[model samples]
Target chain A: MLPYGLVTIEDRVARLLTELPPNPQFPTQGATLFVDLARRQVRQAYTPRRIIETFLAGRGANMFYLYRLLDESLDPIDPSVPLIFGSGVLTGIVPSAARGNATSWSPESGVLMDSNAGDYFPSFLKMNGIDHLVIYGRADAWTVLWLGDGQVEFRDATPYLGLDNIDMRDRIATDLGGTWTRDLAMANITRAGENQVLTSAIMAGPKACYARGGPGAKMGSLKMKAIVVQGQTHDFETAQPYKQYNKEIATKLLNTSVVKNALRTMGTPFLYRPSRVLGAMGTKNNQETTWTDRLDAENITPYRPGMAGCFRCPVNCRPLNQLNDDQADRYGRGDGPEYVTLGKFGPNVGIDQVEPVIRLNNICNDLGLDTASTGSAIAWAMELYQRGIVSKSDTGGLELTWGDAELVERLLFAMSHREGFGNVLADSTRAIERGHYPTEARKYCMAVKGLMQSDPHDARILKAFALGLAVSTRGMDHLRNRVTLEINARINDDPGFKAKLYGGPVSAQPNNYETKERAVRVCENIYGVGDAVGMCRFTTKLFNSPSLPGLEEFSSQIANVTGLEFDADVLDRIGLNIMGVERLINHRLGVRRSDDTLPDRWFDEEITVGAYKTEKIDRQEFDAMLSRFYAISGLSDEGVPAEAWRQELELVLSGPA
Target chain B: MSITVRLPTTLQTSGQDSLTITEPVENIAELVRVLRRQLPGFPAQWDDSMLNFSVNDEVVLHRAEERVLASGDVVEIILALSGGTPVPRSAC
Candidate 1:
């Protein structure tokens, strides 16, 4: 059944060593916990040699390995498509590395998807000695899987089925007789996830979520209500260099970086004013690029009475909003109203008020829905209604009008329950549009590979940002390769800094396409490393701050903490290897060079109302940029991985052709 | 006769929400010079990397000197924070 010289799965397993290569001893490395609900079996296994490169690296690498191991034998919606949670190698050991990854076959994106989230869940997971937890097969009933103190328990979760994320957390606390914030941490879904809504997310804590790619839908499909981790903090012996570097990073983050000042005070809403001023704000489903000042940072600051941060993070960037009685009725209070949430819910939908936007954000979060997808989906429908493609009759006599926050809130509840018209929107924009006006609605869908566009930046003006969104592994996302530094207006003239950062003489002009491939490639590598190490990109060079921790610092930290001798170059290679695996995975799923493209709207529609009017992506220039990107990424013009890349990554093609 | 210049909280002078430029200004550079003179703690020289200017809600991406300002124009002066991209989650 296998081709000549092809390595089988069995062969790869046989070659795996039980222990890591002898290195400086550290407690970061741990066993993979495999839970099989179908057989009611739980087992612990060491990282296999085949995936050790990614396994040792963690997060993004872990996500890549999961996608690589996606069972071609099963359908995308199959419950056997294991939902895997991976802790970063440096997670819990270093500051800003307080994140974890949740990867599964996306029922929405129709591809393998990984969503990263902050909070102490990942740290708790690592504390409980789990590097990666893989849940396999569907449970016979709603169940909660509890792991802590080297014990695994499967408890009945039927009573908690219809609860929102906040209520579920409370119930879990009451049932377990432990405070969720103090001793226990959890990942839970809400009614949206329970109903297998394609846009659902998994709430990681009260404040954060793994909010993309429908990992929540996968969990719901598996009949998993929650996974709780009870952890005891373990102190690791660290070298002097590690301690010194850690202190230096904290000092720079707290006292040095000017960017952190606004972030600390206003959280992500600080970017809102700048986004509007830059003409990047996507208002009214991206038909316009500006909105009312009611959603401005200064205006929104009143509701944000406090701020919070992930474990060990210095910059407390999460805004804790004070909810009114009406807004708190269902969703309850959680941290939010971030830039994206405000952008998507406010300007993108033509609603300008800050409080109402925060209300929508709360409802979406409580329902375990991806705020990006939720807002984008509703925006698309509103646009459809504007175009007269969708009627009030189709919307169950409710007018899908712009700025109708009340109607949007009602639809969100209906979507969670899959009621009437809301059932149609529960899927992606592409699917919803296809089911209605397939031919006419296709262009207005604003989706790339079934995932709705998340970033509220109007892509017509920013060429590299547009390209990044087009080629993202998880379609239409900003987090993957967004060169956030492009927002620095001063960079426009700083060719030297651009040259040094991108490793080429790239233009810093947002609209320029020449030499942009280099910048994109560098960003991809940096983000790759950031995700792999379980560190937030905001604290890394990927964010606008140039002096933030980069590959070299990550390398030093990893060496000092784990004794793994990964130099900066090796870390970059790991990033590239992850890219290579993603390419292969997408290739297997029928993605080609043709699919690596922006929507026609981006190429055709110009920003009509700005000083930078007539700003649109040049198709020919974008194609050339794509070619350069492919060449640099070791891919053919067709976007397929080259033999050299495969050999370099030690990847052998042995599956069905 | 005057341009209403809005300032972010970080760059506000004497906790004022906005400042009025009484001096005649040709462009953002001239406006910045007036602000440096009028407002205490304002940098002596215009740092293009540190501050961003928008005339009538339109971003003057580069060469702020070229963006001609008119009387009664709303020239928003804000700290040059990072660009308009959000982090992975809605929150950081």
Candidate 2:
């Protein structure tokens, strides 16, 4: 049980009603499709923002992300309750407006969480006229929710139980009628989800995936295989009225932004060498920071097929890796070997071969496993083996050695198939806690809450990211606040822009823990705007680069698209409101000061690498930063939001039903 | 005088990570001549490429070849496509 586990649903509702403003109509309007599997009933509820505020209270991405958290599903560990898929209000209305959220109680974190993906899935859902799809109750057997233009059908999914995500997609497509249509979008989990692996990731469409949190395991428990939505014969709705103007401006901005275009050209593999060069690559489960430059971007470019982007996104950062080699003959090709996978599977696990890296990436995609968590799991085990904490006997006679890409490949399959040693590894953080590793080995496990760390940029190097991961509602996530990634030369060189960006140039260093909390706070608010607005952070000017839009620029863009007359201040308030809901959800899930912390390794030890050879977080300084963070968030010392926060935001929480 | 130029993956076709141009060059054409001479026909690869040059973090997006370099100045020729780190999958 959680420390705040006793915080009941009723108590939460009462607190919500106490804190929220009087019921006001939501800024946007849409129909919520509610599906009750047990009752065999599907209902549509036109819940305006006022009613949503009474119960959940949010605008775009925040509402979908936080609503499930506000109720009994707040800490859903194999919950028999509800799971929701929410599209942002402006989803399908702009380029790169392709992210939809799988908002539910995560089996990984045991709290209200979201696993988000960018693709045409959200677009198709919007075209189908549904903003949110809420699934609850239990089915007697395996089922698939065939959600089309105007109809919902519950079909049996028992036949596709053991197939991998790729195969399942093909089978489902054939079942729905053979030819692939541009109109359909599908999300499914493979055997990993079926076995309820803690790191199960949901694969959406063919390439895009919500690759964090084992919410797929929740679907596994429900005996649900996939949720496929097809648009009714019409093309995806365009952002009309201002469609041409919006596209022209957006295209101009995207075209002019060298960063955005570079991503589309090089894909994410470009960061492999640079990350190591910068000493930010998490090597050997973060026991080391840098590795040889041989495995960098140049090595991986040989296998590129072209660039791949999300449905509406003009920026294609996912590199399409096409391999015709013998192993590639087996694993074939897919989108990635992204920096996270390349970082973890490459340096984090001590492997460097680009071919194996690409293969490992495809393996995870097919199995519907989260590469970040899977790589971390293997790396942790390898660390244990390196220290004699775990033996070959423990790993079923397989040597858990570093740089053994083949072994890593075997371990991935083992976990996916629940094979001997894989079963032990698949148990997640508990595998270590349950004495799988020597208790002393816990310090090296680099996890926040229960989920494994996304290991490209180590927290010791990036303090803002460290704090962001520690407090993010969806466990340790980088995308939750993309601003921390902007400790680049651009910010370092320009003091005027730096002053406007962070506090000033003096506080802009990655190692500057004093003002890092300020950056994190700023990033959290603006990223919330992106999530709520359905825009990707990479394109945003606030977090990644100053060349992009800030609050005022974004407000104008929203106005241009939705015809909503929101300014920077209004948008900032909306962002803060979204963040408030997220914090409260985490709070209700039993998050407190103790949980809002980092592993001892980060605070106690200095990074042993280039540039940061003498760097480590000052524990006292970090604590003060935390205090400042809470203060900036308008929360108490305990991280509880002040009632004044609710009053100012006009949040009126509804009591009971 | 040695001026260091960091070669991105696209420009590093010869597997050289970085090139140090000791010969003096005044303009982009001179720099292109040096590159063509050094790597032999590599400058032709620049056609249809969205490449930009940066001198000590200052992006000289236009006429970078024509841009003058100071002695011991660090220059980065980045593929305007994948400019270091923008958005990685699970961007940190």
Candidate 3:
């Protein structure tokens, strides 16, 4: 293993060895393990050019590295490609919203699932003396890695199988002092991971989770149970020159209006009203305008829940609430009931009661299910009930009525256990569509490219969001790119002024589509930069925080931390490099543009209410948007990576073609 | 005469203790003019510019040129656009 730093890895390991009782669970082959330093790969000497290049290239670079380590012949479904957990140079050190990213050829969209779960991996890995950990090859038995001080101890955790996420978290917390914050440690999978359900997620925090692409199931299939890394409190260190830079950035972030207003006050639940007004909040399986009168009925407004935040994030968006009734005993009081969960579980299912929604949120959390997908599935069932397709008999005498909290809670239980009709629902809308409801299944699935869609919002209303969803590697996810802010700002402020800036006919009032192609390109770059730096998108988009402006600054931070110098362009190259490599992997696995498609209902039926009332997204327009997106992204017309882009990124162009 | 304005849950904590704010009024426009004096920094206006008004739970369509308000009427001003966080429209 490489030397740790002012404190060498060997010395740190020896210190840890002295503290813990001798246990055989520690890996015997310590020589094979090594820390791959990422500081040199992320720093830069120049500023302006490096900043742009880093934004353009960082995401691809990470993807390329991950692809090289995986089997090229296997598809995303083959369970061979390794899930690479990465942290950017800014992680652990920079106090803004730096986070960790998970990159893998997804089983959900058969593309790259580049997602940020929370701050645990970023901060923990930094303290453990590393920036990224490429976890490859399946273990023969269920195992867990305890990354602490300087050494990584691999323990056989087979006995902990079948435990829920909450139980796993509780057990881990108890085992390693109850004071260990959830932001510092994460339990990837519990019972749901063991089941290997495609829709399963790796639950984090009290309510935060990496929900898309079944990473939890992937862990189960590999027989890898969980990995917990705890950072030492005294690990914060900074070299000369760059120490002042870090302090200045933190000061600017605290004073920014974006941090004080947009995120701090509303949290993520703020998306509900705008989405509902725009007719994007999917209701009744995207078949109706509104779900219930619950937005007003439940009094679900934003309120502070004391001091709750991720590893160094100032914008504490997670709202904590106390339940003083009988349900509080069974379900512990903690964070969340975010907009997506509340919208899908409450209003979308025809219920407006906040209490039941909270209960359902807790149930999904303990069971380790993706609330977005679970709620979407329930909404689909509700639609099925309304259409007379599913009745009391299908639901085992449970009335699938709208606004029935009791039935909603029961369904959540059934879905998690895979009991009764829950077996069919557990397989996800994609699988369900392919099985029983082939002809009409796509209508209710509300997915794009096989991954289930997030909270309801019509892409057509906001062109940037629509295009982002269309071209997103992992189906209809929004975090991949968020250009909706620009669109929203324009509409909310001055339509005429925005129209001029966007460059189109002022009288025509071109919808989000007019500038979608360009907006999506920029958004992709922004997302790439955020992922590479280990920063949350909300920090940039919502809080308006500026990251390292150029490579010199990035390198300065890295040089101070890891004593390494890297070109800024190298960081930008990382994002594209990762995306190109993942696309190549997907192509080998047989994922194509034809596979990237929205639900049929979006194209066929007209929305009857809200901003997009009486409008339906034209398939032709959507196709045009995708074509433009792919072309700009350096992908071929067929949505495959072009040979030039792949060659430039140093990824092997050889694949299905 | 006077009209009372009810604050939504989000704005209840803004030192507006009572459920309703009473102000003298003539018409929707005049009532808003009166409210500006009553509640400073209230982020709303009463121009015939697509303003939606409700009196005692019933929607009132007021023309910019002709609409008028009477005493003892409970008037609620609804912003055309909504969502994000939970800040009041005036605060936004």
Best by TM-score: 1
lDDT value, residue A26 of candidate 2: 38
Candidate 3 RMSD to the correct structure: 9.1
Query: What's the TM-score of every candidate structure?
Result: 0.92, 0.85, 0.77
Scored against the native two-chain complex, candidate 1 gets a DockQ of 0.28
Tens-digit lDDT string for candidate 3 (A499-564) = 432333221222535546765565565566566666666654322222223334554565565444
lDDT of each: 0.75, 0.66, 0.56
In angstroms, the error of model 2 at A584 is 1.3
- DockQ for the candidates, in order: 0.28, 0.09, 0.09
TM-score of chain B of each: 0.76, 0.71, 0.54
Per-residue C-alpha lDDT of model 2 across residues A271-363, encoded as one tens digit per residue: 565556556678888877778766767677788888777766667777888778555364778878777888888888898778888888888
- How far does residue A648 in candidate 3 sit from its true spot (Å)? 0.9
Model 2 regions lying over 4 Å from their true place: A1-29, A51-75, A178-181, A232-240, A325-328, A433-438, A502-506, A560-563, A646-651, A655-657, B9-18, B21-92
iRMS of each prediction:
7.5, 9.9, 10.5
Compare candidates 1 and 3 on lDDT and give the better one.
1
Off by over 4 Å in 3: A1-62, A72-79, A182-184, A235-243, A291-293, A296-298, A301-304, A325-328, A388-399, A433-439, A486-512, A542-582, A651-657, B1-92
Ranking by lDDT: 1, 2, 3
- Output the worst ten-in-a-row residue range by lDDT, candidate 3 chain A: A38-47
